[model samples]
Target: MPQAQQLDPDTFAVRHRIVLVTAWLQVPFLVAVALLTTGLGQAELGTIGAVAVVALGATVTQSIRARAVLASVALFAASAVLIYLSGGTIEAHLHIFAMLPFVALYQDWRPLVASVGFVVVHHVGVSVLDPEGAFNHHAAQHKPLLWALIHAGAVLVTVVGLLALWKVLEDASRATVAALEQVEAERRRRLEDAERFGAELAREAARLVDVSGRVGEVAGVVRETQEASSQRVGELSRRAVDASRAGEETRERVGSGVATMGDLEQRSGEVESLIVLISEIAERTKLLALNATIEASRAGEAGRGFAVVADEVRNLAAQSADAVDRIRETLVAIRQGTTTTAEVLDQVEAAVDGIQTVQAEVVAVAGEEAAAGEVLAAQVHELTTLAGSLSGAAGTMSELAASGR
Candidate 1:
């Protein structure tokens, strides 16, 4: 067999089934045509028996090509037997040509040629050996060889034409089978590509989902930090304002204390002047008492009592002068202390002013920090939103990938 004849299993099976069916049909059709044309005669019975035997043999054959050849030969032989039994009727001869077309199903020229050879051999052999049996009484008597040649010629022509047509059909079938195989191969390749693409898509989707999850986590952390920073900044701003106000109040109190210390210094000066005047008065009184004692001493005995009183007066005056001197020293020490306290108050006021300046700067910085924190929070929120969108997109992609798979 040629490579073209070796069909795929399904094609071979289909052709085999068609051949079997045609065989069975041909046998019955031959018997019916023989019986109808010849009536209950020995020739009809013989033809029917021969067809039955051939059909049985073809059916029992195991090899596909053998069975096909047997069936083809049998069909042609049965047509020949029918033509003989029908007294070489033209209609019966037409059955031989009809059987030729069925041989094309085998897709091999061998079966067709076998069938043609069977018909040709049977026609030629029967005509030569038993001319009376091969044709009707009239055909046998009138130029039977010529008529046989004519019939053979007609069969040859039909076989040649059918062979040509069968060749065309076989070529077309081979082309179709080749095209179908190519199509099947392309389809398989495409399917494999699709599977690979789907697998790659799935992996990409999984990676995207993982990245989205990480980004979302980072966004959450940033948002949380922003919130904490905003809160801290707000608290610091409030405290800074409070500290600034306290600084201002402290500065005011320091100014008042300095003023009060200045007044104390002025009062200490007045007390110092009063102590000087008392010291001068005590000196004068002591001098006068001394003079009186001298006058009493000059008058002796009678002035003795007066002199003792003067001496006591002089002692009192001296005591008053000493007390005035101690008072003056104490006042001077108080004035010095007041001057020191005033200097200290001035230093404290300057420190308070510096604190106020520092406090104002702290308040401004705190405000700026709070504003920056709010901006950061807004940015974090935007990032979180973007991360959420990415996560959603990744989830959609995952679902699509899974569905595609």
Candidate 2:
């Protein structure tokens, strides 16, 4: 078989169905010819039965090409039988030409050629065998050759026209199949590209999630450090305030001590003046006792007893003067000690004041540090929250990409 003759299964099936339908259609024409010739006799029944049998056999056949070939032969045979049975009716001859176009359904020129050949051979054979039965009329019997030529010419024209049309349809079918194949290839390429893009997107999303998680971890650590530092600063601030209070108290106590030392120094000065007056009185008494003793000696022997009494008084006065001198030395030592103590108290008071000033500055600095630490802690907390949100967003994106893939 030629390439055109060997059709795909679907094409064969379609041609097979056309052949069956055409075969059945021929039955009416065959019946009409039989009725015209024999008037409802056995010949009409025989012709219809033969064509029906052929169509049924072809339909049941396993091979599509065989079915087409059988159907073509059956149709051509029916055309010939109908013409012969009608006593070679001219109208019955048209059936042969009509079959040419129907056979073209096979999309193969071979079936058409076979149909044409069968018609030519049948006409010649039947006309020679029984001229009266093949032509029916006297005129057709005399010029059988002329009639055969005219019928052949008509059939040839029909064959040429149908085959040309078949060629055009076959070309179109092949082109359509090619176009569909190209479209399918493009669709497959697009699907593969989408899959590749989805994979890359999923990887990027996962990377973003990882980066966000790391940032969140760092933010958490920073926030924790800020909180600890803030707590320590607050504690230090409180301690500074307490230290400032203690320094002030110490300064006041030192001031009080210095005032007490000043009072002690004034009392020591008054005691020193009284000791000087007592020393003068003792000296004057001693001089008076000595003069009394000298007057008693000048009064002679009667005044001897009085002179002894005066000497005893002068001795008592001398002892009193010596005691006064010792008392005056003790007072001078006490005055010197009080002055030194007062100077030391003044130095202590000044040191306490300086300490209080330094403590006040420390308290101010510690309070400022605590306030700054609190602000830093708040900022760190905000950053941590932002990082957590970013991490969550990246996670959601990753999940969506995964689901898309």
Candidate 3:
């Protein structure tokens, strides 16, 4: 979660190391300043220089910039004060040169100026105590003037160079701030555009919802109409089938009657022939009776019994004749019935043929109806598949919309 501005302890330590390295490099410079201006004993100079080096080492290790600067300045100021209070010699003024390099070690101008002031004060104090040995001692100290000029020039150049570096660093910091601000502004603009797009998507989704509702209503209405039409067609077909069946039954009954009439007509012809044969048998019986009467008269006393037999034969012949007359009357009725049946049979046969034709037509109509139904079913199945495909497409769109959201 750390951003670009976040500084870790290691990074901070590394920056401090840079400052420490710069401070360490100035140790030689401090020794040079002491050797160049001071003619003190080697032991004292070496002791003071060793102490200065120890102070620089402590300052570099401290890691606190302000503390490091102040400590460095204090060490050099103490050395100058010590040298000045010990003797009224120009050699003690050499410690003043340590201030310039020490100032260069710090980033802040306050610490640098403070350290420079300390060095200046040390120089003033030395001049007051030993005016003849000071760099401005009657303006005739050639070696001190030369050393002063060199130190002053070096100080001026260090201050100017540090100030210039500070200016460049300040400019770069300002540019970094400006660029960060611009990036934040662009990010805000993009967020606003995303919000606008979300609002538009919501409106479009609402519109699609309304359209789906209307389409569902329309589909329901169409389904109802289709069902009603199918029911009506079914009813019409059933009625046609019932009428056809009735006609077929009527025709079958009529044909059966025609066959029965034909049989009755043939039976009537047989009855007529039997009636004529019975009449011939009656005539033969009458003749046999007459012959028996004549034979009885010739037999005298025996003829009486024969005469009785003759009378019985005549009675039997009369009964047979009555029976034949009744049969003849029954045959006449049968003949009349046959004639009527024949006429009805002809009508029945015509009706049967018409019924059969109607049955054929009904079968054809049923076949056509079935074929039409099959076609309609096929169309309905295709539409159902299409609807399923459309539903799948809608589902995909919904998933896409959800993902986008």
Candidate 4:
């Protein structure tokens, strides 16, 4: 299809056709006017017919713009000449109105003025050439020169009026054409702007879509990470509980060892006391033997044999007491050793209990940390997904915008 601007050539061609058709239409009017006028016989009709045919031929052979002026001039000259030869008549003068519209279309006022002048001159020429017909002698000469002049003036004014009306119509047409062109230009500009904006929107949409996709991808990763972290945390929590239980068992074992050591220390102290009692009994026996020996000595020789027996008994008692004293010392040393061992075991047990407590605390902390990590991972995943979704939406928008462009 031809664009609106490109239609101008076609429009001009159509207008030319219309002008040709209008000019052709004037031929019949010319013939009729000739028939109804004075001094216009078959000869005048034939002459006008030939001229009209030639004008139509010229219009068909050439372009409208080229032939319209020629036709108007030729027609005007012929009419004037015929009127001069016929000595003018009302029918001849009135027929010139038909060509006025074509003259206006030609956009050349000269042709219209010439045609009008031709008619006016015909009036004056008729009065000079044939006074009877020019002054309306057929009406009993009742119309005077003033009346004839007034009649000519009326024709002149009518022609002028036609020219004015034609000019106004042409100006209106031009204005309408200009306004249409402006409207078309504005419409084209708006279309371009709309396309540009649509492309921009599509790009934005595409960007959003890309972002959303990335977010979705990130979300997926985060989800996976979160699940893994949760599993790990749960495992760590169980492990930590196991560690705490192990620590408690170790503490209990240490406690049991400490109790056993305390019992051993108590048994050692009892043995030390038994050794001290044996030593005291041996010392009293020795003192009693010594007193008996002294009494026997005062009785002289009879007591000699008794003193030997007492001395032997005294030596045995002294040996027995020394043995008890050494045993007591050994028992005291054993009790001290047992007490030291119990104190060392107690310290070890306390240290083991402390290590177990620390291990339990570490396990508890690990569990908490693992749980926290899982939560953080979940949140990160969600955020990444959201960002990806936003990007995706942007990308889609961009595509849509691009398509619009």
True-structure lDDT of candidate 3: 0.61
lDDT of all predictions: 0.78, 0.74, 0.61, 0.66
lDDT (Cα, tens digit) per residue for candidate 1, span 298-386: 98998999999999989999999889888888888887888888888788878877877887787788778778877877787777777
Q: Per-residue CA lDDT of candidate 2, range 331-372, in tens?
A: 677667767876776777677677767767777776787778
In the range 296-385, model 4's lDDT, one tens digit per residue, is: 799789999889888887898899888887887777787777778778877877777787777777777877877787677768767876
In terms of lDDT, the best-performing candidate is 1
Worst 10 contiguous positions by lDDT, candidate 2: 1-10
| Residue 405 in candidate 2, Cα distance off native in Å | 4.6
Per-residue lDDT tens digits for candidate 3, residues 1-405, read 111232246654564455445445545554555556554567546656665655565565554555545555655545564453444344544554544554444445555666666555545554455544445444534444455455456655666776676566556766887888888888788666656665555555555555555555555565555566566666756866776777677767776777787777777778788878888988898889989988998898989898899989988999999999988887888788788877877877787677668766766776676667667656665555555555555555555455554
The C-alpha TM-scores of every prediction are 0.82, 0.64, 0.43, 0.58
Q: In model 4, which runs have C-alpha deviations exceeding 4 angstroms?
A: 1-8, 25-48, 70-95, 110-156, 166-231, 263-378, 381-385, 396-405
The local distance difference test score of model 4 is 0.66
Name the top TM-score candidate.
1
